[model samples]
Target: MPIGDRDLDGIIDVENSRLLSTYRKFGVVAVKGKGSYLWDAGGRRFLDFMGGYGVAIVGHSRREVIDAIEDQAERLIICHNTLYNPTRAKFLEELFKVVPRNMSAAYMANSGAEAIEAAIKIAVKATGRSLFVAAKGSYHGKTIGALSLTWGPRYKEHFSKLLLDVHFVEYGDPKSLEDAPLEDAAAIFLEPVQGEAGVRIPTREFMTSAERRCRKAGCLLVIDEIQSGLGRTGRMWAHEHWGISPDVMTIGKGIAGGIPMGVTVVSSDYADVLRLGEHTSTFGGNPLASAAAAAVLRVIEEEDLARNAERMGHRFSRGLEGLEGRFRIPREHRGLGLMAALDMRLRIQEVIPRMISNGLISTYSGLRTLRFLPPLIVDEDDIDTSISILDTTFGAIEREKRSM
Candidate 1:
């Protein structure tokens, strides 16, 4: 049946009934998006700071990305890895230019989880080892293999038996990583910036020490950049900020301009470990995703979105910090580039809906942290508007508290 023929409310009801209750719904039925804003089914406009969990870096419905997708769809959409296509080849060449210089081979997949899964498989194949090390508060992906390396008890408690031999170390502590047993490890997975754990930024010393220890132990260092990569942190890759290189890197989210695409990039030394028949995906590196990815790279370079992310990030962070003084509230502001968080003194559950009601959209990390991931295309005006809405919401909440 045509989508237009179906009643929106009825469709939602059917979805709720048929689909597994895995995701927590937010009530807003987002129908469209462009640049830095979203429009709900009722035509209510919202300033989108959530960016679909960091997938809209280049902005929603960008013309270049949309054009590429449309043009590729006209010719071909899916061509299995069994055959080589021009768009896919060009995408690989463009992709390598932005990633670490040493990264030579890339295995494409459909999501961040698949990218982490590929990284795990390649690391294991290269080192012939089974154990892995990951940082506390790090989120890799939800798939069993990737979940094994992810460091959240809430996510792992139900699927404990499916996890692999993985050890957790304190983030931003060089001593912890240096002391971890890595002799028999295949790889140590780390996020350049822990995203789900409230946009935690690690110290330079910790990252450098981890790299050195990984080298010393001859273990593959896999950096998961699914949320922190592709200009989200004002750099092509977040690890670039610390001048550290990983043996393998998993990247996704915004890599293909919202198209479902993930990549595990491996250095030349370990690229051949995953033999031709050993690792493959049916829909990986297809023409449509490749075309979209290539266009995104071009736009990022042409528009210099990375530098914009840096400039705007500073402005936004400073604006958020100002709130603490104005409201006399205890808060902490932490971020790198555009990926930032505001840890409010009060619970965030009450503020999120209020912000939305006032025409702003954001997300929460943990219980009290409000995370902001606005599109790279966001301007000074957009930032200011979001901050204003936040200020009004905070003031209203405070007034209510005092009245009570």
Candidate 2:
């Protein structure tokens, strides 16, 4: 169906009836997006701070990404991994230039979950161990292999019988790593900044400790940068903030500039563990996504979005922090480079819709934290506008509490 012809109600009804009821609806039928804004089916413009869960790294409908996609699609879209394609080769070349120097090999997949799954296979094959270590409150992905390492039982309780052996350690606590059993572990999965855990940032000591422990146990350090990489957190990779390098790294959610693409990058030492036909994906690194991703890399470097994210993120965080002095709602504000969040005193379910009604959109971490992932291209005006909307909504909610 044509996007313009579909009304909000029709689209909503079709999705609610036809799709699996696993996702929580945001109540906005977004039809178009450009730069830092989204347009609903009713032509309402919204400041998109959620950025499609950090997929729109370069922002929605970016000309460079769109042009790349169009140009590649006109010639070819899909070429299996068995064949060497120029676009795919170009993407790998672009990827290596930005990644850690040791990361010389990559396995392309379709989503962060696929990337995590591939990392799991690579770790096991490379280390020849059955156990793994992950942190508490960590969220890797929902696939079987990735879920085994994820925290929270709600996602894996039903599939407990199928999961692998994984030990959960306390995040940001070096003592926990020292106490955990890691002698026979295949890998230790860590996210530089825990996004789903309300933008949790670990201390440099903890990150270095994990790296040390991985070396001590003869296991690989697999950093999952799916949400934190690609200049989302000021740095190209969040782990760089701690000055620690991982043996294997999984990245997605903007690698292809909104196209579905995942990558499991490995160091040169373990590059050849996955032999021919041991692992492969049909649409991984296809011509269309490869071209788009290559363009995304160029845009990030050429435009210096990382610097923008740093400057804008500090401004946005300060604005949010200032609200704590005037409002009785948000308890605290914490974040790093465009990935800001407010741990609210009230339920975020009531707050998100109000902000949406006021032409702003954000996401939530857990139940009380309002997470903001504005695009790397966001300007001071956009940040201020979002802050104003949040301030207004938070004030209104506080007033209602006073009345009650």
Candidate 3:
């Protein structure tokens, strides 16, 4: 292995031997990225449709982010919250501009899970209740507190005892929320667009019902926008599509362009619940990450990337929808903005590697859905190229199956 890069075999071997087996391994050893493309150690370029799991909202290695990181790094990296760093203050000011008007305060953390953890604490303190309601097929985060809200059993069965008391309800069904036991609940958590459930977009009626139910039951509405926010869903926040404002909101993924950051925005109605020193993070709101996040906000506003996502997302959705008719494997396409999915009759495990081989990298939500989270900066040309890659890869796979 070298300083700047490593051979593919060496990189793979090192990761396989030294790292935990929690991650689904991919063969491409990516060494560099710029805009909507990633370059592997072997010098092959890949159209980054995955967008680093929606963390590259402004595209990889964006110059503004780089400059912000470097400039902040040179000046200062960490200034404890008690000291009040200007960079952290600046980041919060930028963040508040995009969130709901009632969301008057925020707590910054290092990842979505951390933000969710903070929200859990806030909800508990505000309502004095321990029970929560979350939708089935929901994914808030993997941390213990956040994982309690997540629906998948596989992720939390062993650690269930450490989790919160959360009741699961069917997503996109207003009746489910109405039937749910919410009187004693602190909050009802949900995603406007379910990403890990394969880009499931709920009906507007369902969202309105949730808000109504929360209000009637005296429970807070907590929206998890870790995957669907920050212009990825064509809107500043996915909740905008349904015209709902959450009492508490958790956002992460691309908040800092690439630097790790998570935020829990609390409405003024419940902002005073948490006392000083009741909950705090050692690394939260560090100047380095704050500076990068501030730059990301500026980029989103200056580039009008949210509108671009709306335009390009329609193009991408149409292309994926067209494939459903041409290929036997494709069953349907579902998505909003750049957050989209193609459901196939067959599992996409094998199809994933084949797409990588064809210079396209995608991800999956479940066994049969091919999830695409392209950069918001993606153009019509990028959408066409990705569609072409999907066509070629599916054609080859179908041909192989026929010959077999």
- Candidate 3 Cα misplacement greater than 4 A, ranges: 1-4
Better of 1 and 2 by lDDT: 2
Cα deviation in Å at residue 293, candidate 3?
Answer: 0.6
lDDT of 1 by residue, 203-303 (tens): 99999999999999999999999999888789988999888999999989998999999999999999888876888889999999999999999998899
Local accuracy of candidate 3 as per-residue lDDT tens digits, 1-404: 36347556767878898899899987889889999999998889999999999999999999999999999999999888889788998889899999989999998899999999999998888888999999999999898899999999999979978989999999999898888998999999999999999999999999999999899989999999999998888899999999998999999999998888899999999888889998888899899999999999999999999999999999998998788878887899998999999988888887999989999998898899999998899998999999999999999999999999
TM-scores vs. true structure, each candidate: 0.97, 0.98, 0.98
Q: Which candidate is the best by lDDT?
A: 2
Model 3: how far residue 192 lies from native, Å: 0.6
Model 2, global lDDT: 0.92
Error of 1 at 273 (Å): 0.5
| Clash count, one per candidate | 0, 0, 0
